[model samples]
Every structure is written in structure tokens, then in C-alpha cells.
Target: MDTILFYTPGTCALAAIVTLEWLGQPYRLCRVQKAERQSEPFLRINPRGQVPAMLVDGRPLLESNAILAHLVDRRPELALLPRHGTWERDIANQWLAYLASAFHAAFWPMLMPQRYTLENDCQATVRQAGEEAVRRELRRVDTYLEGKDFIQGTRPSALDAYLHAMSRWGNSLVDMAKDHPNLWRHQKTMARDPAVRFGTAVERGEPPPEPHALVGHVELASITL
Candidate 1:
């Protein structure tokens, strides 16, 4: 079960890295540079040219949600996720879906306004709109966490890792404590975890020999689950 994860700084790929850490699985990390993500070599591996591309024994896997889910599936003993055929698991899946669709979508326009509009001047408007949407969505998440320490109640799941990474994108623009205390509290709790710190440090472009434990290894030629 050799796993290789390709990621860039501060992307949702942190979720996969964190999940692997939580599972205590021996895997490899490939820190793809921002400029090289869309390069031919990476594109050949993942046509989407996205970060967090995990190669399990040489079988390329894309999509952070699916990759995280697959990790949970492979290591049920870790209880990284809720039990199968249970409402708790369903709720966890819902959170993952929301992060994949709603939470992640809100950042696109703000990060890449040109993709939303053709007019140069309208880019600001698009960015502003995106920022507002991000705030609204984040607020909703905060409200949802009013009485819950994690997305699935008391336990920290991959959803927490995903939310922690995504929430960082908004930290510069919005103060979570002042605007979204519940979510802010959750993020603070998540930050204390070594796995979360390791994933985030790598995302922040931390070089080798840092304080973090998780690090990438040599890439494999080919293998599958």
C-alpha cells in the first residue's frame, strides 16, 4: 500500500495529507511547485492539473474528497470516519460534499476573478462578490458548529482537516473569532493536532528538515490498491 501524494502549498490537498497522517500510514509526498502543477509531467499524471493527486501503488487518484474517502475505506480500523451504514457516516459524507461543492466553489472567483469575467474592471467586482459569498458560506458553517466541536460532533474527521485548510484562505480577509466564533474555535482545536500542523507546514512551503514529521518519499513506478 504505497501511497504518493502530490500537493502544492495551501491547497485542499492538506486534507489528504492530514488524513494519511491520522491513519498512521506510510506514504510518500510530492510537493509540486505552483508553476509546475500544470506542466506536462503533472498534467500527464492528472489531466485536471490539480493538487492533492494521490498515487496509490502507482494508480493515480484525483479529487480530494474521493481520495480522503478512499483512505478511510482502506483503513477502517483507524475510525478516521464514522461507521458504515450509519447516520453519522451519512452526515460526514454530507460535510465532505459541502466542502467539495459549496465551500470550495466560493473561493474560485475571489482567487481567480479573470475566469469569472472578461472585462478587466469587472474583475474587482467579481472578486468582491466572491469574498462576500465566502463570508456567507463560512458563517453558515460557523452556525452549524454552534454546539459541535467537530463536523461530526466530538470526533475530528477528515472534514475538519478540509475545513481547516479552506478556512485559512478566508483568514486574511475575515477574522473568524470576531465573525465566526464556532468555526474559529474548531480551527483553533484542529491547529493543536500534530497531523494538522504537519499538513499545513508542508502547504506553507516549509522546506525539508522542518519540525514536522510528515515528509514525501521516492515516487514509485507503478502499483494499485
Candidate 2:
């Protein structure tokens, strides 16, 4: 299989990268600079001009959740998703949609106000609303994680990967560690996971280092324009 992933640092691309690493799959990494995403060459890979687009056998795949599903389905041994007939599958689907539609979408306008409106007043209002929505979504996840180690059970699933990536945004925008204990613990746990560490290192343009304890480590870095 020839797989090439076009990714932007610290974006939703991290989830797909983590999932691919966990599956022990070998693939080429194509860095997509934020400023160049709109260029013709990058646009050819994904007309949407989005990162985390995967090219499998030269066929393009866009959207993080879709790429994640493809990866897990193609590598069943990784067990990122539950068995076909289980309730876990449904729960996994729920969280996938939640991450894609709810958590991830909530932050888009705030990150890129130009797409939403040209007016400063309208853009500010939209950005503020997006920020508030993000906070609310974090609380929802925190509550859901209260008594669970992972989203579905003891082991981390694809949902965990999705949530971990989206949660990183919260860590950057909001001080989740101070406000949400369960969510904070989840982020800490994910930071130590081998796949997560590798994915994050790749996102930050750093090499993977020896494993270390991550109890007090913060998962997200401040994002600047």
C-alpha cells in the first residue's frame, strides 16, 4: 500500500497520524504549511485546502474522521474500533461525530473569522460564540470521562484518538487542566501513549524521544498566528 499523508502541525491531522502509528503502518508524511494550504499544488490534493488528507494508492481521502475509519478498517489488528456488533461501535461512532461536528466545528470560526464574515462586529460575535461552544463541549467530555479510563472501556479506542486531538485545541484555547480534572487526566494519559507521543513529535517537527512519565506534562502548546 502506498500511503502519503498531507498534514498541518497541531491540527486534526494528529489523530490520523496517531491512528496510523498505532497500527504500525508505514507511510510518507507530506508537511502542509498553513500558509501554503491554499496554493494550487496543495489544492490539487484536497480541493477543500485542508490538511490530514491521505493519499492511498494515489487516491485522495479527506476529513480526519473519514481517514480514521479507513485506517482502522484496513488494520483490524489494531482494534481501534470495537467489533461490528457491539455497543462499543455505536459509542465510538457517537464520539467520532461529536469530535468532528461538535468539538472540531465549534472552533473553526474562531480560528478563521474571514470565512464566516467580512464585518468585524459579526466576526467578533461568531468567534466569541465559537469559544463559548468549545467550553461547553469540553465540559460534556469531562462529564462523560468521569468514571472511565477511555471513551468506551479500559483500552483507548479511535474515539480516544479523536478526543485527544480535539482536546488539544481546548488545552491551547482554554485552561482545561485547571477547570476539568477528568479531561485533564485524559489528556495526560494520552500524552504518554506511544502513538500520541509519536504523532505529537511529528506535528511539532521534532524527533521521537525515549519514553518518559507524563503525569504533570501539558499536552497542548499555545497556537499563534
Candidate 3:
């Protein structure tokens, strides 16, 4: 196959998965179990031991943004992103960077609390701090999203897929409706999209109807790279 993706459950990988489906390009999904990320074979493909890794034509694209950017670039006529090098593209890149760096890191405490402290007693404190950090990031995005149908230009783009995935993570930690109405509304809007819903179901480990772009799923052992 020309394209294959390795993803862990509940990670931001959903964004890329949704993007691939949106492109309607033939691609395969390889859902990795959480423990498998640290395995020797998996590490060979991605030493950092994190997920949302894409293997396109036998080469690895390890970062989420890089994977998404490649997918978007493949089908520019769809305008999944604004035209490259434009002011709008810069703004879109800014949000993608913010989500990948600040927003994603804020969830590490909750997602991998053991890494935060050697002592188990400090876990709750670390998680509480994480919640606060997530709220801060949410506030920024929520504010920016005011009176906007999507995060970027008027149409739905890869930006919406990226935001929808991360914002769903934040919603799990806080009451988005009461604390972040705009964000809550954004979530509602994104969830209604077919691609978004398909991505959501797939990440949730459900048997979602496969999209035409989904070449099918592959086993990790079957993938050489």
C-alpha cells in the first residue's frame, strides 16, 4: 500500500484519520494498542514511542502536523487548507502549531500521569495542574472561535479536524457547555460532519462504516516500515 497509519486509541491521531477520509484517497489504518507503542518493533518505526505515525510509500512521517500537512498538500483543490504562503495559511499554521504543542502537552499529565512524578501521592496534584492548563488553552481557542463557524476561513478544513480532536480531549476534563459555550458549540458543529463522526467512531474502537478512502486496516506485523 502507498499509505499506512499507526495510531493509539484516544490520541490526537483522529485528526489525520479524518483528513485522509476527507481526501477520499486509498489509505490503511493500523490501530496500535497502548502497550504496543513501547515495543521493540514499534520503536524501530518510531523511537519516541508516541503515536499518530504515518508511513507513506515505505517512509515514516512521525509528527501529527507533518502527517496532516502532507495529506492536505496531496489534495489542494479541496482546500483542506488555505493556499500555501498566504496570510490565511500562516494563521492556520499558527493554530495547528498551538494545538500540537500547547494544547496536546497539557493533556500529558492526565494521559500519562506516571511520567509526571515518581511518587504516586503527587499524581492528583499533577492532574489538577493539567486540568488548569487545558482550561487555559481552551479559553484561548474558545475566545478565538467566537462568531466563527470554523477555526479558520468560512469553510471546514483540516483545521477543524485538528481542533475537533483536541477540543474533545478538553471537554472530557471540564464542562465545556457551562464553562466554554463557544467551544461546546464548536464541538457540536464538528461532530455533525460525516468525516468527523467516522473518525470519532473509529478512534472509539467501534465498527464504523468504512469510507471509500479506507483501503482497509493492516496488521502491525504486516507493515515492514
RMSD of each candidate relative to the true structure: 2.8, 6.8, 1.5
Instruction: Decide which is better by lDDT, 1 or 2.
Output: 1
Clashing pairs in 1: 29-216, 57-223
TM-score of each: 0.91, 0.89, 0.95
Say which candidate scores most in TM-score. 3
Q: What residue runs in model 2 are displaced by over 4 Å at the alpha carbon?
A: 210-225
- Best first by lDDT, ranked: 3, 1, 2
Q: Candidate 1 — what's its lDDT?
A: 0.83
Q: Where does model 3 exceed 4 Å of error?
A: none
Residue pairs in candidate 2 whose N, alpha carbon or C atoms collide under 3 angstroms: none
lDDT of 3: 0.85
Predicted structure 3, TM vs. truth? 0.95
Better of 2 and 3 by TM-score: 3
